[model samples]
Target: MYLTATLDEMTEAQLLDHADEVSRTQRKCEAQVLRIAAQTAVLNSPETIDPDVARLPGRERVVRFGGVGTPDVAEFAAAALGARLEISSGSARSLMADALDLMIRLPQLWRRVEALEVKASYARFVARRTRNLTPDQASYVDERVAEPADGRIPWSRFEDLVAGLVVASDPEAAAEAEQASAQQQVARPTRSTEDGMRGFFIRAPVPVVALLDGRVQWIADVLRSLGDTDGVEERRVKAVAVLADPHRAVALIEEFAQWRDGSGERPDVDWSSVMPAITLHVHTYAGPEPTDTVRVEGHGPVTGEWVRRHLGPHARFTIRPVLDIAGQAPVDAYEIPERHRQAVHLMTPADTFPWGVSTTRHHQIDHTVPYRRDGTTGQSRVGNYGPMSAFHHRLKTHGKWQVHQPVPGIYFWRDPYGATYVVDHSGTRRLPAPEPPSPAERAVARALFGLAA
Candidate 1:
């Protein structure tokens, strides 16, 4: 008997080789199991067995008579396989059905699987997909798929190839199938989950889904332009809210028309109330120009092209230097300045909590050391300030969660359960690194260069 080597004793290359061998073995075992199930199905087929054919006592030959039908065989097989494989009876039954389908409908595909030339899962997938296909059409699909010159084909590509072949081989059948599918399209009733959340499901045509997605994205883009720097999920919810309200819908359409035609009066909408101030960060040393890369507050790093396209000519620009304060003593200021607030927003654009729920505009400037607990207000200094979502700020303030800023943008957070985590631009991480400069820095650098010329 061959002894298996321990993982600790194996080299990296050896471990990889062992993994491939194990995968091949597993595939072979799966193929063998499926083949056995198929064989058992045939053996118990009523058409293949005869009850009156058996003879006893000095008979030249004796054969077993009529066995159980397919239903009885399936039940026995499911029960036995379920017990042996430690799977549910329904799964076992499904597996047996797929195996029989492969054996009877796509024999060549089944043979390739049995020989381990094709994976069992792939064979099962082919079997299920070709159920609607005639034997000839299935054979054609099997011939195209089974023996790829370039080893195993990827599942996604395989699916596409099968779909294309199916449509090309029988367009009328495909059309009928599509018509049947359209008839099945429906919007399911809203249901409540075990959790507090409610779920709604819709099964519609692809074009309808695409239109809905485009509309949502348009609303989200508008919100972002107005300084509503919420996450994608929040923006989507806001889009839905706008769509549900007839007043907001009309306002949005009017704004869109005015922007498009440049003829209508400016809408009396107060964007300042709805929008948050966005700060963009850029690193001067990274590239010769500011447009090389840009970072948006409440959003992570974006390309220079994105900055130029999104910010455009109408957006305002401001330039400021990074604050430098060297002292252990806290500053006396209770209220943070606008410039300090912007700096804090630039440093930690999004919420500095693990959940990253809100944008910097919505976040509160939290003192690393609470003032009531002898913590300094570290005035106008980036090191003293951190932006936290309202929820997380309350948790730290009253729920006994401790947060410390060892560096300007890097924060260390300790939960009530004693687990410590590092929070920064990339959300929660195990290690700390310097935060990149905001887009405002890049904008300033670009303007200064333009003026000097």
Candidate 2:
């Protein structure tokens, strides 16, 4: 009886190992059957490849069926399918190779599933053994396995639900609706560049009339065009020009009196306030050069020399196409700060440890690489500290530590998804977080802990 039982156990293990191979064979068979059905459908109908003959067995069948044979229909009948056939030798060999490849890969897939099961079991064991977890950690484990609360869903399912609703209401319009939905998915959220530029304006050597009202508008249009174009990764451009000052123009007019045949005074337009005051001498950069140089010919060559000469002692201002210059300072002297201020974001409650085991807490802080020891102040700002719990701090202080092979989760759980939730107990359910001091449950828990709200 013992020998028989041992043999049965070995057989069961063998079957389990080869389960994936069996599944692969099943899928291959299903695919072949589908292909055969499709091929057969093409050969066995009035809509056959020739499209001429409708009846099989040709003239005799047409007479037997009491239908007159059309010439087109007769031609279709001639090519009718006679028998179900097997795939050719070359095709069969190729299919066999694919199946064999799948069979060879079975071990890898099996190993992955086995690994996942083993890891999950280990976590369960640890959770059950370690009874000191905080309320928060226990709740998190429960939340993960429970049905999603508040109907919140992952993105894939959200999209599927939207499509199903659209399809159910208007079946005929489904294709167009789906296409429109796809387009919406591809479009990024629209933000007004104008909002980021409330205080700024670009002053080119060109007229404020030209630069602000006209040239700036043209630049925005160009950026829109760039966004629509395929294969353009990123782009930057600078414009410069040599503009004649209002005073120098009189002498320039005397130099070219012949051209002064403007017939009469054609209204002296205020070029000072209307047009920009500085001259552009040169500009240079190593980025996407304009594809159509002709479009920009009216403006100066935009060379580096032009930029330096007209824009003053490289201190007054800087200019770039498609960029707002208002919130910015003059380019010659201004440098972007090396440090920037950012808002301190709150951590998700889902991740916060509960009942604070100092070891686990310290582990998290150390793992997160929070504030390093500064050698002077015993305390550091939270920003400087890696995200670790108070628990981990205790361990490092008390235990003989392994600097190289330190306990995991010292600073933070590096990859939250990487940690497995072990079963602490065999299918035990946990209650939800108690409602705020409703003058009832909160009072009870607090009373037990000997505290007051």
Give the top-scoring candidate (lDDT).
1
RMSD, candidate 1, Å: 20.5
lDDT values for all models: 0.62, 0.30
Candidate 1 per-residue lDDT, tens place, 1-453, comes to: 113778898876567557767878898799888877666656555444333442444422322211111233423445577677788877776677778767766777777787777778877777767766776777776776666411233444455446655554565676556557658777765766856766657776444454466677777877676668899889987887897797986687567546755776866555453333433444322434222334443233334444454454435666555544332244467677776776677577667765454553767888776655345445436687878777878888899888888887878887665556777554454332346556787677778776321
* Pairs of residues at least 3 apart in sequence or in different chains that clash in candidate 1: 50-66, 51-66, 280-438, 280-439, 280-440, 281-437, 281-438, 281-439, 282-438
Q: What residue runs in model 2 are displaced by over 4 Å at the alpha carbon?
A: 1-12, 45-453
Predicted structure 1, TM vs. truth: 0.50
List where candidate 1 sits over 4 angstroms from the true fold. Answer: 1-4, 47-75, 148-151, 194-196, 256-264, 267-453
Query: What lDDT does candidate 1 reach at residue 279?
Result: 36
Model 2 poorest ten-residue lDDT run: 340-349
lDDT at 374, model 1: 48
lDDT of 2 by residue, 1-453 (tens): 233344356555454435534554554554454334333333333443332333334432221111111111222222322222355543432332222221222223213223332122222222232122233333332233222211233233323323332232333344443335434422133444674532223333432223434433333334444342422222112111101243444333332332334545444444344333433322233445321111011242222332334334433445544222222221111111212000011121111232121211112333222233444442222222223245544443444222221222222221121221211111111223234567776688788997766
